[model samples]
Target: MTEGRVALITGASSGIGEATALELARRGFTVYGAARRVDRMARLTAHGVHVFEMDVTDDASMTSGVERILHEQGRIDVLVNNAGYGSYGALEDVPLEEARRQFEVNVFGLARLTQLVLPTMRAQGSGRVINVSSIGGKFYEPLGAWYHATKFAVEGLSDSLRLELRPFGIHVVVIEPGTIRTEWGGIAADSAVARSGGTAYARQAKRLAEVYELADRPSVGASPRVVALAIAKAATEARPRIRYAVPFGAKALLALRWLLTDRAFDWAIMRAYGPR
Candidate 1:
Protein backbone atom coordinates (compact mmCIF):
# COMPACT_ATOMS: atom_id res chain seq x y z
CA MET A 1 0.00 0.00 0.00
CA THR A 2 2.89 2.35 0.72
CA GLU A 3 4.75 1.32 -2.39
CA GLY A 4 3.99 4.35 -4.49
CA ARG A 5 3.61 6.84 -1.67
CA VAL A 6 6.23 9.59 -1.87
CA ALA A 7 7.96 11.46 0.95
CA LEU A 8 10.11 14.57 0.96
CA ILE A 9 12.35 15.13 3.97
CA THR A 10 14.43 18.24 4.51
CA GLY A 11 17.70 18.36 6.51
CA ALA A 12 18.35 14.86 5.29
CA SER A 13 22.10 15.14 5.38
CA SER A 14 22.22 13.67 8.91
CA GLY A 15 20.59 13.12 12.28
CA ILE A 16 16.86 12.54 12.58
CA GLY A 17 16.27 13.65 9.02
CA GLU A 18 18.78 11.16 7.66
CA ALA A 19 17.45 8.39 9.85
CA THR A 20 13.87 9.11 8.81
CA ALA A 21 14.79 9.03 5.16
CA LEU A 22 16.29 5.57 5.54
CA GLU A 23 13.46 4.27 7.68
CA LEU A 24 10.82 5.51 5.26
CA ALA A 25 12.68 4.07 2.32
CA ARG A 26 12.84 0.74 4.10
CA ARG A 27 9.10 0.88 4.53
CA GLY A 28 8.67 1.11 0.73
CA PHE A 29 8.06 4.85 0.17
CA THR A 30 9.90 6.61 -2.58
CA VAL A 31 11.84 9.05 -0.45
CA TYR A 32 13.51 12.22 -1.62
CA GLY A 33 15.99 13.62 0.89
CA ALA A 34 16.84 17.33 0.63
CA ALA A 35 19.58 19.31 2.37
CA ARG A 36 22.24 21.95 1.79
CA ARG A 37 25.09 19.47 1.80
CA VAL A 38 24.47 17.37 -1.26
CA ASP A 39 27.63 15.37 -0.76
CA ARG A 40 26.81 14.42 2.81
CA MET A 41 23.70 12.58 1.61
CA ALA A 42 25.49 10.45 -0.92
CA ARG A 43 25.31 7.47 1.44
CA LEU A 44 21.52 7.71 1.30
CA THR A 45 21.65 6.86 -2.37
CA ALA A 46 22.61 3.30 -1.52
CA HIS A 47 19.31 3.00 0.32
CA GLY A 48 17.42 4.18 -2.76
CA VAL A 49 16.75 7.66 -1.36
CA HIS A 50 17.02 10.44 -3.91
CA VAL A 51 19.07 13.41 -2.80
CA PHE A 52 18.41 17.06 -3.59
CA GLU A 53 20.50 20.09 -2.67
CA MET A 54 17.98 22.26 -0.87
CA ASP A 55 18.55 25.25 1.36
CA VAL A 56 15.24 25.71 3.14
CA THR A 57 16.02 29.38 3.82
CA ASP A 58 16.19 30.01 0.08
CA ASP A 59 12.89 30.24 -1.78
CA ALA A 60 14.38 29.21 -5.09
CA SER A 61 15.90 26.05 -3.64
CA MET A 62 12.69 25.06 -1.91
CA THR A 63 10.50 25.70 -4.94
CA SER A 64 12.72 23.80 -7.32
CA GLY A 65 13.06 20.87 -4.94
CA VAL A 66 9.30 20.51 -4.71
CA GLU A 67 8.89 20.84 -8.44
CA ARG A 68 11.40 18.13 -9.08
CA ILE A 69 9.59 15.73 -6.76
CA LEU A 70 6.16 16.51 -8.19
CA HIS A 71 7.45 16.16 -11.72
CA GLU A 72 8.87 12.75 -10.97
CA GLN A 73 6.33 11.30 -8.54
CA GLY A 74 3.26 13.34 -9.54
CA ARG A 75 2.33 13.73 -5.85
CA ILE A 76 3.84 13.93 -2.40
CA ASP A 77 2.17 11.86 0.29
CA VAL A 78 4.40 13.12 3.12
CA LEU A 79 6.53 16.17 3.79
CA VAL A 80 8.91 16.22 6.75
CA ASN A 81 9.99 19.81 7.40
CA ASN A 82 13.15 19.03 9.36
CA ALA A 83 15.79 21.58 8.38
CA GLY A 84 16.67 23.70 11.44
CA TYR A 85 19.50 24.65 13.81
CA GLY A 86 19.90 25.98 17.32
CA SER A 87 21.25 29.53 17.62
CA TYR A 88 22.17 29.34 21.28
CA GLY A 89 23.10 32.59 23.05
CA ALA A 90 21.74 35.01 25.61
CA LEU A 91 18.93 37.08 24.08
CA GLU A 92 20.83 40.30 24.78
CA ASP A 93 24.02 39.15 23.09
CA VAL A 94 22.52 37.36 20.10
CA PRO A 95 22.26 39.58 17.02
CA LEU A 96 18.85 40.28 15.57
CA GLU A 97 20.14 39.20 12.17
CA GLU A 98 21.15 35.82 13.53
CA ALA A 99 17.77 35.46 15.18
CA ARG A 100 16.05 36.22 11.89
CA ARG A 101 18.13 33.64 10.14
CA GLN A 102 17.16 31.07 12.75
CA PHE A 103 13.50 31.79 12.16
CA GLU A 104 14.10 31.80 8.43
CA VAL A 105 15.26 28.21 8.58
CA ASN A 106 13.21 26.89 11.48
CA VAL A 107 9.87 28.66 11.30
CA PHE A 108 9.41 30.58 8.03
CA GLY A 109 11.13 27.94 6.02
CA LEU A 110 8.89 25.19 7.43
CA ALA A 111 5.76 27.30 6.89
CA ARG A 112 6.64 28.21 3.30
CA LEU A 113 7.43 24.62 2.42
CA THR A 114 4.11 23.57 3.91
CA GLN A 115 2.38 26.19 1.76
CA LEU A 116 4.10 24.89 -1.35
CA VAL A 117 3.11 21.30 -0.69
CA LEU A 118 -0.45 21.91 0.56
CA PRO A 119 -1.83 22.59 -2.88
CA THR A 120 -0.53 19.32 -4.21
CA MET A 121 -1.73 17.46 -1.12
CA ARG A 122 -5.15 19.10 -1.46
CA ALA A 123 -5.40 18.02 -5.04
CA GLN A 124 -4.79 14.45 -3.90
CA GLY A 125 -7.04 14.81 -0.86
CA SER A 126 -4.46 13.14 1.40
CA GLY A 127 -1.04 14.03 2.77
CA ARG A 128 0.94 14.37 5.97
CA VAL A 129 2.98 17.42 6.98
CA ILE A 130 5.48 16.53 9.68
CA ASN A 131 7.16 19.49 11.29
CA VAL A 132 10.29 18.59 13.27
CA SER A 133 9.77 20.75 16.30
CA SER A 134 11.38 20.22 19.72
CA ILE A 135 10.44 19.89 23.37
CA GLY A 136 11.77 23.43 23.59
CA GLY A 137 8.54 24.45 21.95
CA LYS A 138 6.81 23.77 25.24
CA PHE A 139 9.56 24.86 27.65
CA TYR A 140 12.44 27.30 27.92
CA GLU A 141 16.13 26.99 28.78
CA PRO A 142 19.14 29.26 29.15
CA LEU A 143 20.90 30.65 26.05
CA GLY A 144 18.19 29.37 23.75
CA ALA A 145 15.75 32.23 23.39
CA TRP A 146 15.82 32.42 19.61
CA TYR A 147 15.85 28.68 19.02
CA HIS A 148 13.01 28.07 21.43
CA ALA A 149 11.03 30.91 19.91
CA THR A 150 11.21 29.30 16.49
CA LYS A 151 10.06 25.96 17.89
CA PHE A 152 7.23 27.63 19.79
CA ALA A 153 6.19 29.17 16.51
CA VAL A 154 6.28 25.74 14.90
CA GLU A 155 4.03 24.32 17.60
CA GLY A 156 1.40 27.01 17.09
CA LEU A 157 1.67 26.83 13.32
CA SER A 158 1.29 23.07 13.28
CA ASP A 159 -1.70 23.24 15.60
CA SER A 160 -3.50 25.71 13.37
CA LEU A 161 -2.58 23.83 10.22
CA ARG A 162 -3.85 20.55 11.65
CA LEU A 163 -7.30 22.05 12.14
CA GLU A 164 -7.37 23.78 8.75
CA LEU A 165 -6.29 20.69 6.85
CA ARG A 166 -8.52 18.21 8.66
CA PRO A 167 -11.37 18.76 6.23
CA PHE A 168 -9.11 18.01 3.29
CA GLY A 169 -7.69 14.82 4.79
CA ILE A 170 -4.30 16.45 5.17
CA HIS A 171 -2.85 15.83 8.61
CA VAL A 172 -0.25 18.10 10.20
CA VAL A 173 1.89 16.43 12.84
CA VAL A 174 4.60 17.98 14.98
CA ILE A 175 7.48 15.74 16.06
CA GLU A 176 9.06 17.07 19.23
CA PRO A 177 12.42 15.49 19.98
CA GLY A 178 14.37 15.82 23.18
CA THR A 179 18.15 15.44 23.46
CA ILE A 180 19.42 13.47 20.49
CA ARG A 181 23.00 12.56 19.68
CA THR A 182 24.01 14.53 16.61
CA GLU A 183 26.16 17.37 15.33
CA TRP A 184 23.28 19.66 16.33
CA GLY A 185 24.75 19.88 19.81
CA GLY A 186 28.23 20.79 18.68
CA ILE A 187 26.89 23.47 16.37
CA ALA A 188 24.74 24.89 19.11
CA ALA A 189 27.59 24.86 21.62
CA ASP A 190 29.86 26.63 19.16
CA SER A 191 27.25 29.31 18.57
CA ALA A 192 26.61 29.69 22.27
CA VAL A 193 30.30 30.24 23.01
CA ALA A 194 30.80 32.50 20.01
CA ARG A 195 28.00 34.98 20.77
CA SER A 196 28.29 35.13 24.56
CA GLY A 197 31.78 33.85 25.25
CA GLY A 198 33.56 37.14 26.03
CA THR A 199 30.58 39.04 27.39
CA ALA A 200 29.57 39.34 31.05
CA TYR A 201 27.53 36.14 30.56
CA ALA A 202 30.66 34.29 29.53
CA ARG A 203 30.77 31.96 32.51
CA GLN A 204 27.09 31.07 32.35
CA ALA A 205 27.21 30.80 28.55
CA LYS A 206 30.22 28.52 28.64
CA ARG A 207 28.54 26.31 31.20
CA LEU A 208 25.47 25.95 29.00
CA ALA A 209 27.71 25.19 26.06
CA GLU A 210 29.17 22.28 28.01
CA VAL A 211 25.67 21.02 28.67
CA TYR A 212 24.86 21.19 24.98
CA GLU A 213 28.13 19.46 24.10
CA LEU A 214 27.15 16.56 26.34
CA ALA A 215 24.66 15.53 23.66
CA ASP A 216 27.54 14.00 21.72
CA ARG A 217 27.92 11.30 24.34
CA PRO A 218 25.82 8.26 23.47
CA SER A 219 24.47 7.94 26.97
CA VAL A 220 23.28 11.53 27.20
CA GLY A 221 20.54 11.38 24.56
CA ALA A 222 18.35 9.12 22.48
CA SER A 223 19.58 7.87 19.16
CA PRO A 224 18.34 9.55 15.98
CA ARG A 225 16.62 6.26 15.11
CA VAL A 226 14.27 6.71 18.04
CA VAL A 227 12.87 9.93 16.58
CA ALA A 228 12.92 8.50 13.09
CA LEU A 229 10.69 5.65 14.14
CA ALA A 230 8.25 8.09 15.68
CA ILE A 231 8.16 10.13 12.49
CA ALA A 232 7.43 7.02 10.44
CA LYS A 233 4.59 6.09 12.74
CA ALA A 234 3.07 9.56 12.50
CA ALA A 235 3.21 9.56 8.75
CA THR A 236 1.70 6.11 8.24
CA GLU A 237 -0.80 5.71 11.04
CA ALA A 238 -4.44 5.64 9.98
CA ARG A 239 -5.49 8.08 12.70
CA PRO A 240 -2.31 9.91 13.52
CA ARG A 241 -2.14 12.26 16.48
CA ILE A 242 -1.30 15.94 15.91
CA ARG A 243 1.91 15.82 17.92
CA TYR A 244 4.48 13.12 18.69
CA ALA A 245 7.09 13.87 21.38
CA VAL A 246 9.96 11.40 21.14
CA PRO A 247 11.95 9.68 23.92
CA PHE A 248 9.38 8.94 26.62
CA GLY A 249 11.22 11.22 29.02
CA ALA A 250 10.55 14.21 26.79
CA LYS A 251 6.88 14.19 27.69
CA ALA A 252 7.73 13.88 31.38
CA LEU A 253 9.98 16.93 31.12
CA LEU A 254 7.23 18.88 29.44
CA ALA A 255 4.87 17.85 32.21
CA LEU A 256 7.38 18.92 34.82
CA ARG A 257 7.51 22.38 33.34
CA TRP A 258 3.73 22.54 33.15
CA LEU A 259 3.43 21.68 36.80
CA LEU A 260 6.27 23.88 38.04
CA THR A 261 5.89 27.48 39.13
CA ASP A 262 7.75 30.14 37.17
CA ARG A 263 10.29 30.65 39.90
CA ALA A 264 10.75 26.93 40.35
CA PHE A 265 11.31 26.46 36.66
CA ASP A 266 13.82 29.30 36.69
CA TRP A 267 15.67 27.73 39.57
CA ALA A 268 15.73 24.38 37.82
CA ILE A 269 17.11 25.89 34.62
CA MET A 270 19.76 27.77 36.52
CA ARG A 271 20.77 24.67 38.39
CA ALA A 272 21.08 22.77 35.09
CA TYR A 273 22.71 25.38 32.85
CA GLY A 274 24.17 27.98 35.19
CA PRO A 275 27.84 28.16 36.10
CA ARG A 276 28.88 25.19 38.22
Candidate 2:
Protein backbone atom coordinates (compact mmCIF):
# COMPACT_ATOMS: atom_id res chain seq x y z
CA MET A 1 0.00 0.00 0.00
CA THR A 2 1.34 3.41 -0.92
CA GLU A 3 0.64 5.60 2.08
CA GLY A 4 0.56 9.37 2.28
CA ARG A 5 0.27 9.75 -1.50
CA VAL A 6 -2.50 12.21 -2.29
CA ALA A 7 -5.06 11.64 -5.05
CA LEU A 8 -7.73 13.97 -6.44
CA ILE A 9 -10.63 12.59 -8.47
CA THR A 10 -13.12 14.89 -10.21
CA GLY A 11 -16.78 13.93 -10.80
CA ALA A 12 -16.62 11.76 -7.77
CA SER A 13 -20.28 12.16 -6.83
CA SER A 14 -21.39 9.10 -8.75
CA GLY A 15 -20.63 6.25 -11.10
CA ILE A 16 -17.04 5.42 -12.07
CA GLY A 17 -15.55 8.52 -10.49
CA GLU A 18 -17.09 7.71 -7.11
CA ALA A 19 -16.01 4.10 -7.35
CA THR A 20 -12.42 5.04 -8.21
CA ALA A 21 -12.27 7.45 -5.31
CA LEU A 22 -13.21 4.72 -2.84
CA GLU A 23 -10.89 2.17 -4.41
CA LEU A 24 -7.90 4.52 -4.29
CA ALA A 25 -8.58 5.52 -0.71
CA ARG A 26 -8.85 1.87 0.29
CA ARG A 27 -5.46 1.27 -1.25
CA GLY A 28 -3.95 3.78 1.18
CA PHE A 29 -3.93 6.94 -0.92
CA THR A 30 -5.22 10.12 0.66
CA VAL A 31 -8.15 10.60 -1.68
CA TYR A 32 -10.14 13.73 -2.36
CA GLY A 33 -13.43 13.18 -4.18
CA ALA A 34 -14.88 16.24 -5.94
CA ALA A 35 -18.19 16.84 -7.69
CA ARG A 36 -20.83 19.47 -8.36
CA ARG A 37 -23.38 17.78 -6.12
CA VAL A 38 -21.51 17.45 -2.86
CA ASP A 39 -24.54 15.99 -1.12
CA ARG A 40 -24.59 13.04 -3.45
CA MET A 41 -21.12 12.05 -2.28
CA ALA A 42 -22.08 11.70 1.35
CA ARG A 43 -21.32 7.99 1.23
CA LEU A 44 -17.79 8.68 0.07
CA THR A 45 -17.20 10.74 3.18
CA ALA A 46 -18.29 7.83 5.33
CA HIS A 47 -15.63 5.68 3.72
CA GLY A 48 -12.93 8.10 4.85
CA VAL A 49 -12.69 9.85 1.51
CA HIS A 50 -12.46 13.62 1.63
CA VAL A 51 -15.47 14.97 -0.24
CA PHE A 52 -15.58 18.44 -1.75
CA GLU A 53 -17.80 20.47 -4.10
CA MET A 54 -16.27 21.17 -7.46
CA ASP A 55 -17.69 22.08 -10.84
CA VAL A 56 -15.13 21.31 -13.52
CA THR A 57 -16.65 23.90 -15.87
CA ASP A 58 -16.10 26.56 -13.23
CA ASP A 59 -12.51 27.79 -13.15
CA ALA A 60 -12.64 29.10 -9.62
CA SER A 61 -14.18 25.90 -8.32
CA MET A 62 -11.49 23.78 -9.90
CA THR A 63 -8.70 26.10 -8.83
CA SER A 64 -9.88 26.36 -5.27
CA GLY A 65 -10.32 22.58 -4.95
CA VAL A 66 -6.79 21.93 -6.18
CA GLU A 67 -5.32 24.63 -3.99
CA ARG A 68 -7.16 23.34 -0.94
CA ILE A 69 -5.81 19.85 -1.59
CA LEU A 70 -2.30 21.19 -1.87
CA HIS A 71 -2.71 23.29 1.24
CA GLU A 72 -4.02 20.37 3.25
CA GLN A 73 -1.93 17.50 1.88
CA GLY A 74 1.16 19.38 0.70
CA ARG A 75 1.32 17.29 -2.52
CA ILE A 76 -0.79 15.59 -5.20
CA ASP A 77 0.61 12.37 -6.58
CA VAL A 78 -2.37 11.44 -8.74
CA LEU A 79 -4.85 13.59 -10.63
CA VAL A 80 -7.82 11.67 -12.08
CA ASN A 81 -9.56 13.88 -14.62
CA ASN A 82 -12.87 12.03 -14.40
CA ALA A 83 -15.41 14.86 -14.48
CA GLY A 84 -17.35 14.61 -17.76
CA TYR A 85 -20.63 13.66 -19.42
CA GLY A 86 -22.10 12.60 -22.74
CA SER A 87 -24.24 15.03 -24.73
CA TYR A 88 -25.73 13.15 -27.66
CA GLY A 89 -27.30 15.01 -30.57
CA ALA A 90 -27.03 15.50 -34.31
CA LEU A 91 -24.47 18.20 -34.96
CA GLU A 92 -26.85 20.01 -37.25
CA ASP A 93 -29.65 19.97 -34.70
CA VAL A 94 -27.77 20.47 -31.44
CA PRO A 95 -27.49 24.10 -30.40
CA LEU A 96 -24.01 25.60 -30.62
CA GLU A 97 -24.26 26.75 -27.01
CA GLU A 98 -24.99 23.22 -25.80
CA ALA A 99 -22.16 21.88 -27.98
CA ARG A 100 -19.79 24.41 -26.47
CA ARG A 101 -20.98 23.54 -22.98
CA GLN A 102 -20.23 19.91 -23.71
CA PHE A 103 -16.69 20.84 -24.65
CA GLU A 104 -16.34 23.04 -21.60
CA VAL A 105 -17.34 20.16 -19.35
CA ASN A 106 -15.85 17.17 -21.13
CA VAL A 107 -12.72 18.58 -22.80
CA PHE A 108 -11.60 21.99 -21.61
CA GLY A 109 -12.42 21.29 -17.99
CA LEU A 110 -10.24 18.19 -17.97
CA ALA A 111 -7.47 20.13 -19.70
CA ARG A 112 -7.73 22.99 -17.24
CA LEU A 113 -7.55 20.70 -14.23
CA THR A 114 -4.58 18.92 -15.77
CA GLN A 115 -2.87 22.24 -16.34
CA LEU A 116 -3.36 23.07 -12.68
CA VAL A 117 -1.72 19.83 -11.53
CA LEU A 118 1.21 19.76 -13.95
CA PRO A 119 3.33 22.23 -12.04
CA THR A 120 3.01 20.33 -8.77
CA MET A 121 3.70 17.00 -10.47
CA ARG A 122 6.67 18.48 -12.23
CA ALA A 123 8.01 19.75 -8.94
CA GLN A 124 7.68 16.31 -7.38
CA GLY A 125 9.16 14.61 -10.42
CA SER A 126 6.82 11.65 -9.79
CA GLY A 127 3.11 11.78 -10.54
CA ARG A 128 0.44 10.22 -12.66
CA VAL A 129 -2.59 11.67 -14.48
CA ILE A 130 -5.45 9.32 -15.19
CA ASN A 131 -8.04 10.50 -17.70
CA VAL A 132 -11.40 8.77 -17.83
CA SER A 133 -12.28 8.61 -21.49
CA SER A 134 -14.71 6.21 -23.17
CA ILE A 135 -14.85 3.46 -25.80
CA GLY A 136 -16.53 6.19 -27.90
CA GLY A 137 -13.09 7.70 -28.10
CA LYS A 138 -12.13 4.88 -30.46
CA PHE A 139 -15.39 4.12 -32.23
CA TYR A 140 -18.25 6.41 -33.21
CA GLU A 141 -22.04 6.37 -33.33
CA PRO A 142 -24.88 8.35 -34.86
CA LEU A 143 -25.93 11.46 -32.90
CA GLY A 144 -22.64 11.33 -31.01
CA ALA A 145 -20.68 13.92 -32.94
CA TRP A 146 -20.01 16.31 -30.07
CA TYR A 147 -19.53 13.61 -27.45
CA HIS A 148 -17.18 11.52 -29.56
CA ALA A 149 -15.21 14.57 -30.61
CA THR A 150 -14.50 15.46 -27.01
CA LYS A 151 -13.37 11.93 -26.20
CA PHE A 152 -11.20 11.78 -29.30
CA ALA A 153 -9.67 15.01 -28.15
CA VAL A 154 -9.01 13.45 -24.76
CA GLU A 155 -7.29 10.50 -26.39
CA GLY A 156 -5.02 12.72 -28.43
CA LEU A 157 -4.38 15.08 -25.54
CA SER A 158 -3.39 12.24 -23.25
CA ASP A 159 -1.01 10.80 -25.82
CA SER A 160 0.79 14.10 -26.33
CA LEU A 161 0.84 14.74 -22.60
CA ARG A 162 2.53 11.40 -21.90
CA LEU A 163 5.44 12.36 -24.10
CA GLU A 164 5.69 15.90 -22.80
CA LEU A 165 5.51 14.85 -19.16
CA ARG A 166 7.92 11.94 -19.51
CA PRO A 167 10.90 14.15 -18.70
CA PHE A 168 9.17 15.32 -15.52
CA GLY A 169 8.65 11.69 -14.52
CA ILE A 170 4.90 12.13 -14.82
CA HIS A 171 2.82 9.40 -16.45
CA VAL A 172 -0.40 10.10 -18.34
CA VAL A 173 -2.83 7.21 -18.64
CA VAL A 174 -6.18 7.15 -20.46
CA ILE A 175 -8.97 4.94 -19.12
CA GLU A 176 -11.35 3.98 -21.91
CA PRO A 177 -14.44 2.63 -20.22
CA GLY A 178 -16.88 0.67 -22.30
CA THR A 179 -20.56 0.83 -21.39
CA ILE A 180 -20.63 1.15 -17.64
CA ARG A 181 -23.57 1.09 -15.28
CA THR A 182 -24.35 4.79 -14.95
CA GLU A 183 -26.98 7.46 -15.49
CA TRP A 184 -24.87 8.76 -18.37
CA GLY A 185 -26.75 6.81 -20.99
CA GLY A 186 -30.15 8.12 -19.97
CA ILE A 187 -28.97 11.71 -19.99
CA ALA A 188 -27.34 11.28 -23.37
CA ALA A 189 -30.41 9.68 -24.88
CA ASP A 190 -32.66 12.40 -23.52
CA SER A 191 -30.43 15.07 -24.97
CA ALA A 192 -30.40 13.42 -28.38
CA VAL A 193 -34.18 13.14 -28.48
CA ALA A 194 -34.59 16.68 -27.29
CA ARG A 195 -32.28 18.06 -29.93
CA SER A 196 -33.02 15.96 -33.02
CA GLY A 197 -36.48 14.56 -32.36
CA GLY A 198 -38.24 16.72 -34.96
CA THR A 199 -35.32 17.12 -37.33
CA ALA A 200 -34.60 15.12 -40.48
CA TYR A 201 -32.30 12.86 -38.47
CA ALA A 202 -35.04 12.01 -35.97
CA ARG A 203 -35.23 8.35 -36.84
CA GLN A 204 -31.51 7.70 -36.62
CA ALA A 205 -31.27 9.82 -33.49
CA LYS A 206 -34.08 7.87 -31.85
CA ARG A 207 -32.55 4.57 -32.89
CA LEU A 208 -29.16 5.51 -31.47
CA ALA A 209 -30.88 6.72 -28.33
CA GLU A 210 -32.44 3.27 -27.88
CA VAL A 211 -29.04 1.67 -28.38
CA TYR A 212 -27.52 3.83 -25.66
CA GLU A 213 -30.35 3.08 -23.26
CA LEU A 214 -29.95 -0.65 -23.76
CA ALA A 215 -26.17 -0.56 -23.54
CA ASP A 216 -26.17 1.12 -20.15
CA ARG A 217 -28.11 -1.63 -18.43
CA PRO A 218 -26.48 -3.71 -15.70
CA SER A 219 -26.32 -6.84 -17.82
CA VAL A 220 -25.07 -5.00 -20.89
CA GLY A 221 -22.32 -2.88 -19.36
CA ALA A 222 -19.49 -3.74 -17.03
CA SER A 223 -19.58 -2.60 -13.43
CA PRO A 224 -17.97 0.67 -12.39
CA ARG A 225 -15.63 -1.39 -10.18
CA VAL A 226 -13.98 -2.79 -13.27
CA VAL A 227 -13.03 0.71 -14.35
CA ALA A 228 -12.09 1.68 -10.82
CA LEU A 229 -9.64 -1.20 -10.56
CA ALA A 230 -8.10 -0.31 -13.90
CA ILE A 231 -7.71 3.31 -12.80
CA ALA A 232 -6.20 2.22 -9.48
CA LYS A 233 -3.68 0.13 -11.38
CA ALA A 234 -2.76 3.09 -13.56
CA ALA A 235 -2.36 5.28 -10.51
CA THR A 236 -0.26 2.78 -8.58
CA GLU A 237 1.78 0.89 -11.17
CA ALA A 238 5.31 2.12 -11.64
CA ARG A 239 4.91 1.88 -15.42
CA PRO A 240 1.32 1.89 -16.52
CA ARG A 241 0.10 1.40 -20.05
CA ILE A 242 -0.72 4.65 -21.82
CA ARG A 243 -4.30 3.41 -22.20
CA TYR A 244 -6.49 1.09 -20.12
CA ALA A 245 -9.71 -0.05 -21.77
CA VAL A 246 -11.77 -1.61 -19.04
CA PRO A 247 -13.59 -4.96 -19.18
CA PHE A 248 -13.36 -7.41 -22.06
CA GLY A 249 -16.06 -5.82 -24.22
CA ALA A 250 -14.25 -2.49 -24.48
CA LYS A 251 -11.07 -4.22 -25.60
CA ALA A 252 -12.99 -6.20 -28.17
CA LEU A 253 -14.50 -3.07 -29.70
CA LEU A 254 -11.13 -1.37 -29.76
CA ALA A 255 -9.66 -4.40 -31.50
CA LEU A 256 -12.52 -4.40 -33.98
CA ARG A 257 -11.88 -0.76 -34.74
CA TRP A 258 -8.17 -1.40 -35.29
CA LEU A 259 -8.77 -4.40 -37.52
CA LEU A 260 -11.54 -2.88 -39.63
CA THR A 261 -11.17 -0.24 -42.29
CA ASP A 262 -12.70 3.14 -41.53
CA ARG A 263 -15.47 2.54 -44.05
CA ALA A 264 -16.06 -0.97 -42.76
CA PHE A 265 -16.41 0.31 -39.20
CA ASP A 266 -18.81 2.98 -40.36
CA TRP A 267 -20.89 0.33 -42.07
CA ALA A 268 -20.94 -1.72 -38.87
CA ILE A 269 -21.98 1.25 -36.73
CA MET A 270 -24.75 2.02 -39.20
CA ARG A 271 -25.92 -1.57 -39.04
CA ALA A 272 -26.17 -1.24 -35.28
CA TYR A 273 -27.74 2.21 -34.98
CA GLY A 274 -29.05 3.26 -38.38
CA PRO A 275 -32.76 3.50 -39.15
CA ARG A 276 -34.11 0.13 -40.24
12-129 per-residue lDDT for model 1 (tens digits) = 9999999999999999999999999989988899999999899988999999999999999899999999999998988999999999999999999999999999999999999999
Identify the candidate with maximal lDDT.
1
Q: What's the lDDT for all of these models?
A: 0.93, 0.92
lDDT score for residue 55 of model 2: 92
- Clash totals for all models, in order? 0, 0
What lDDT, from 0 to 1, does candidate 2 have? 0.92
* Location of the lowest summed lDDT over 10 successive residues in candidate 1: 212-221
Worst 10 residues of 2 by lDDT: 209-218
Off by over 4 Å in 2: none
- Tell me, what's the RMSD of every candidate? 0.9, 0.9
- Give me the runs in candidate 1 sitting further than 4 Å from their true place: none
Residue pairs in clash, model 2: none
